[model samples]
Target: MALDRWIALVFVTFCCAYGYLAFATMDQLLPPFMQRNPVWPSTFPKVLAILGVIVGLVVLFGLEKPDSQSEPSATDINYRRLHEYKLGQALMLLGLMALYALSLRPMGFLLSTTVFLMAGSAILGERRWVIMFAVSAVAAGSVWYLVQQVLGIFLRPLPFFLGG
Candidate 1:
């Protein structure tokens, strides 16, 4: 099989896995809203999951099959290289996001988000230290401000290092 086909298959498999997880875990443990509408709880995610499964199946089996013994041209190889770089960056970002999620309650919003943003930028080849730090700080601050002030989510401040 071609490398592109393999990559497509992997992506399709990931979509299927995501859909399965979403389908299996589409419930809120919290009680029905005391003062809000009850119809908004789990509908969106379930709908997205259903769509994901359908798309995954289509992608897995729908694309034109590549020639079995043909080697890709230089340009095709270059494109594949770029594709792999993007895929790697995406996977790292996803991992960092998961870590941030796990650390949200314990480490608080500011710190976890700062780490997530900085790590993701660095991994994606942001070489300027000043830019990375500034971007990370701004990104974290924006999210913190939105959640705490605008949305009233009341995210916890970072530890003393961040000077709540």
Candidate 2:
């Protein structure tokens, strides 16, 4: 849909900004010794930003063009549903995301992400406590394992007291 193209464009903008920040700010923060390494701390964020830009570009231009003579088709989204937007929930989610970012290093990936996921789900109206906890734990732990162990990215998966 054309709306998707707009979203992709916005995504591309965000990626470009993030990449620029990684290049301009993050790289300079590393000490000379660490900067000399093949993979500096900024490397991952830059790579991710590049990948995001590529994906956004693909989404932006890969769609079929609508014929000029044809009427609007079912592919178009029903913007009328915009009335269902919940401002309070969105603001709460944004605040939660900010808190998660702040807590990531101090609390470690496993605990921070698990709590974030659980609280996010509850904010979005999930009521099953057991299921929510299980899903949150699995999702966060799996991501932590993949990023830290499999990818060798060195995330702190547990608290400092637990020797993460």
Candidate 3:
């Protein structure tokens, strides 16, 4: 896992640098009136930079050092397996997101949303039909009610399934 450690360190470094840049660069061109907002525009990024710095330091110095005594063995999976697994997971997520987006238009709000929730649960390895159906139904109905009746926004109805 040396490579994973190195990758983690690099990611932390990038996050710290990115947050510093956001703090430094946000208001360079803004007018004085805009800068006087009740909240400092740089507040969130500064907090992020602080968090990133702490996390980076922890990763660089605090992790346990691997034992040096074990003999190398052939039972360990190689880097190729890691790469293939990551790629497969990425593709699955991409397909699920595509289905969610496509269904939103034609199927409208409720059914599309239910399918999206069910697909997400499936992707996460949930297989119990009763639980999947119950959770998806509740989630979709809640989102639909909150977005439509409570908020008073006429959501695109599930015209495809419920009929136009």
Local distance difference test, candidate 3: 0.75
Model 1: per-residue Cα lDDT at residue 129: 81
TM-score to true structure, per model: 0.56, 0.55, 0.62
1 versus 3: better TM-score goes to: 3
Q: Give stretches of model 1 more than 4 Å off.
A: 1-42, 63-95, 160-164
Full ranking by lDDT = 2, 3, 1
User: Could you tally the backbone clashes for each prediction?
Assistant: 0, 0, 0
lDDT of each model, Cα atoms only? 0.70, 0.87, 0.75
Top TM-score model: 3
Model 1, residue 40: distance off in Å is: 6.6
In candidate 2, what are the lDDT values of residues 1-164, reduced to their tens digit? Answer: 55678889999999999999988998766877896699888889999999999999987885455447365466555565555668789999999999999998889899999999999999999999999999999999899889888999999888888888
Residue pairs clashing in model 1 are none
Give one digit per residue, the lDDT tens place, for model 1 in 1-164.
44555566776677667666655665546355532666554567667766765665555564443657365555443543575556777888888888988988778787878877788878888888888788888988998898899999877877645554
Task: Give residue 15's error in model 3 in angstroms.
Answer: 1.2
